[model samples]
Target: MTPRIGLILFTALLMQCENPVKTPLPGAETIPAQIRQTDCFNGGNALFHAARITEMGNRASGTPGYRRQIDYLKEELAKYGWTCREQGFEKETPQGPVRFVNLRARFGKTPNFLDPVRGLLTCHIDTKQGIDGFTGANDGASGAAAILETARILSGEPARAGNLELVFFDGEESFAEHMDSDDGLYGSRHYASAMQQPLPKWMINLDMVGRQGKKIRIPSMTPQ
Candidate 1:
């Protein structure tokens, strides 16, 4: 099986926690009840962001659309007090060597110390290549919108935000019709290779999560 398929299966297994959808946010107990009730994940806002991102047109790697998407994400993320940085790398593809940029964000405008983050949230922002006028609304923009919403929500909880990292990867879609080891996952692979000590305890990678009426099932043996 491909690496991407294996990663998907692993993520599915990890997502089987009890009451997965309804599970309270980390450190929810410390939050005020009023805030918990009123301030929550906003699906409407997420949908709006998704629509706006999709309207930017094709976001294939190294394209003008991709650069526009990056600028938009950086602008929005800065509004919520998150500091953004680009991790740019070059890798050989089936066509040729292409440069890809992955956006990483952390809480605080300028963090003084290098605190070890416990959790990671990531999604690819690049649309598939070779498809004319393909906006990747559900495939690319949706995941990014989800992360953007999550970032907005997490901004309210400094402790939680400090312990987490958000990454928007590029070049997830292969240049060719079929993905192989060398042709796909350029951003993720580069990020993984460049990771330092004290890796994140958990990671959640979102893809094609904006589809309507999609049902996510949790296994019975999930932990509470």
Candidate 2:
């Protein structure tokens, strides 16, 4: 099984609150020049999309904002010749039963529903509910933006190695003040239950991946 890539986009607020100035990595100049080039990751492009998503306000599950976010993803993916669909499910939440949609996209021929895909990339698009001024700028939007950029680049490439799916999950955040096991990850849980075939061996989960002057801390956790 191929190892999954997980991206965490820490919020700029977190960086600012923690420290205004970021600590520079030691021997940074020893790194390849291409590594720092904007064209490599196109972080500027990702940031633009992130800004647009943040403008939509809170994207809590079943809300208009969340629906709009889904629509935006569909449109963008389609533009890259990727077919997209929404898998809808209802979950019991603190407020009530809420509908969540997992937005999925695939390039090239649609794989059979029962066939196993080789790679799957995922990110949560829903923002936490009831938090004032919570736009999920870094938590949700940044990850989505990074996914968009990745999709754009991959879609334009001449060769792709395997059958791949990009998933943007909703209802990842808890509606209540604090999250318990049952309160969050509704979309992913539903997807896991609903799949009829083997899950992709390689899954890339992205979150909290974009913020200026912030160094990402990569947890030494990868499936063996």
Candidate 3:
């Protein structure tokens, strides 16, 4: 169930707590000038879709299927040169603390704890529990795949120097069979606190990337 208006505002308050920003790398640039500019984001979009579907089959966390999903992702991302780290946290709720996971993929080492990252690209990897194993077909995997594919496009470019950061978050699915601030998006909330990533110049969160006729509804009637 989606959060009510009051709950939405309340969660926004929690998430808005001034995340400490990381400094930028010297001579850092946003986009590469040499982009082929020919719908390159499309292939990345496709990869995101495929991964989303595959991951949806499992990934409820603490399950064998979830472990397999994490292993596959770690291996695939390593091929792209990201230093992957699996940081685990436990979230508190009425039931007490529940374990959660987050996967961080860094391009290079940072001067401080959090890299002075140019961009933050993220997608949740966990599927919802009540929906036939949540084949998250578009919920979590597409965004992760998009970031990975984007990394390839950014290879050797100045933008990638301290340029990109990708996170495949676990527990985006809430506990107790549904999502709410108390239960869901736990991985991101934990990561933001633990690793302290720099504020991304741009953040693009993608879901349901492969759905036909996908239409995005914006808040305040403004273009995102």
Candidate 4:
């Protein structure tokens, strides 16, 4: 049975690498002049580190840790002149009902339009619970750190006037330990559902950030 499972996993890996989608038109059209001068390959890594400090432990669907994470994001966003707010939603678990919070911030003149909103940067700040001796480090912290640091970098630009929105979603983790239709992506679904105008031309969703050196795998239908 072990050998069979290993073979199946190998096959799946092979299938994934069999075809690489054509690269899409790269973004960052409004990159600031100072960034254009940096020779280092890292576009933004400093700010991401700040976000990792908030999670004392698991940021599961309903917990104090999750609330703290949201507050951290809110504070950071406000420092950048971003108007921030939390949209509340309920998370129902076998244990009980938990109130979830989604932190959304918008920067730019017309948040409702693209002419002002040059792009969107986003990730989840909630940490995952560990059973026994395990606690998430990379899985929960990586993406949040990346986006937070990016927020700092982009907002720091003297010429930073382009439209941008950074959102920290909640309830991304599945109550069942694995994401499925019945248990995950609550925040994103609600945010997307509330949009009365055309969605941003670009949106980045960060999930399962534990693995490093990851290559973004865009869907076949994704614009290239």
What's the lDDT for all of these models? 0.78, 0.72, 0.57, 0.56
Over 1-224, each residue of candidate 1 has an lDDT whose tens digit, in order, gives: 23343344434433323433444455412212221222556556667788788888989999899999999999989988999989999888888988899999999989643467777789999999888878998999989987887788778899878878899999999999999877899999888998877877667788898765445454454433
Off by over 4 Å in 4: 1-51, 108-118, 157-162, 208-212, 215-221
Q: List candidate 3 stretches off by more than 4 Å.
A: 1-56, 93-97, 108-113, 156-158, 195-198, 213-224
Clashing pairs in 1: none
Residue 81 in candidate 2 has what lDDT? 68
Let me know the TM-score candidate 3 reaches against the reference structure: 0.66
Name the 10 consecutive residues with the lowest summed lDDT in model 2.
28-37
* lDDT per residue (tens digit) for residues 127-178 in model 2: 9877889999889998898778677766755245236778898888888888
Ranking by lDDT: 1, 2, 3, 4
Better of 2 and 3 by TM-score: 2
Q: On residues 126-177, what C-alpha lDDT tens digit does candidate 4 reach at each position?
A: 6555565333555656666656555555565524424566777787776666
Q: Tell me which of candidates 1 and 4 scores higher on lDDT.
A: 1
Candidate 3 lDDT over 127-221, as tens digits, reads 76657645665676665555555555444453443455667788777667656657777887877776453465555455555444443333463
Which residue pairs show backbone clashes in model 4?
24-224, 47-149, 48-145, 48-149, 59-127, 116-163, 117-163, 118-163
Comparing 1 with 2 on lDDT, the higher-scoring candidate is 1
